[model samples]
Target: MVRAGARFMATGPAQSFLRRYGWRIDRALIKATKGHLSMSMVMPEVLLTHTGAKSGQQRSTPLTYFTDGGRVIVVASNYGGVRHPAWYHNVKANPRVTLTSRGYRGTFLGEEVLGDERDRLFELATQFMPNYAGYQKTTQGRRIPVVAFTEVR
Candidate 1:
């Protein structure tokens, strides 16, 4: 098992600084660390690969995903920032995606949940990490989005 606290200790400073500067330093750290921090702290079960909506380029992001029956749930809080994250926009443009988890990698279909479904999933996710509640409070009016990715084929 990876020590979650240790991973946070490694990236906490950078994350905090970036949060203040209105930049995504976490992405840089994740890329530089090659998923080490995510593996250690977040226990990320899925790495989402989304094609750029306009450019059609491939973009991959490691996210903390949780399995709910047959679907995979991912949060789009972006630490409750004013703007949506790049990955969120990528998924919005292209609903098809790929994911890797538990040494398994495969293609999947993605979609944003709606209404009660989204609320329920958000509640479930908050149970896993209560900090999400604090994250929600950081935003002014935009409600954080929760996206669901389901296996295809």
Candidate 2:
């Protein structure tokens, strides 16, 4: 049932609604629980904080993430939407980021991965949540970005 619902939520109005409100609820839960929870019924989630590109304001986004060799990976699929997520652009403008995950918080430098690296990370992300495949399908010609966040000293 969860898988079926996940497929349904991967596109159309269901996804739009969830995209509008789901992250807000997840962020609240993370704040309340101190990162014990954010993404349930799915892969690991992180609360990523970054400086806005234009506003220079701090922004926080809850995202499902995977890890490779201690580096955090996140996708900019934006539910297969044509436009990228705001956080993606933020990280691009300023790679330094602060993230909270699994009850722990740390700082990192975000970088967009491409070529073979993106393909590999995308595979891992898809395995974590099959819905990402649907996201890629919906985005058409646009290439969804794969970002890696390595810890900052």
Candidate 3:
């Protein structure tokens, strides 16, 4: 467990930077690192991609995901912000999604988990990335949503 003071100290800059440019910054970091940072240091199976939701336009982002029983789990922590992240809404609107990682590309179906199932997945996610606990803490009064994606044939 991260000390409360340390958690606060670390989150200040991280939250600020992520809020300002987390999408682009994390995408670039993932591309440059070739999924090394996300997979090894963070979680596994993250990619940067652009897709259209309601507007049928293009939206690109770098997100950390992991596979559990063949389902891909994604955290909408947004560092525990009050509202859901942009990609969360995008995927919610359009379940069809595309991803690219380490030279591998594919399409998948995206779905959000709720209630007890969501809680269970969130617990599993925290095991891989403890910072998620801090993110959950930072976003008080709000429930972080966890999204699951399954490959569409």
- Tens digit per residue, CA lDDT, model 1, 1-153: 233432452366745764564133434445555434433344454567799988899987766667888998998988768777788999999999987665566788888999999999999887776656767887787798999998899
Residue pairs clashing in model 3 are none
Best by TM-score: 2
Q: Judged by lDDT against the true structure, how good is candidate 2?
A: 0.85
Per-candidate Cα lDDT values, in order, are: 0.72, 0.85, 0.72
Residue 69 in model 3: lDDT? 87
Q: Give the runs in model 1 whose Cα sits over 4 Å from its true position.
A: 1-14, 17-37
Across 14-93, the per-residue lDDT of candidate 2 in tens digits comes to 77777889888888888777788864545578999899999999988888788898899999989888989999999999
> Which 10 successive residues of model 1 have the least lDDT summed?
1-10
Winner by lDDT between candidate 2 and candidate 1: 2
Model 3 per-residue lDDT tens digits across residues 26-138: 67776776555442242354773546666788776777677788877899987677788888988888878887665566788888999999999999888766668877887
TM-score of 1: 0.77
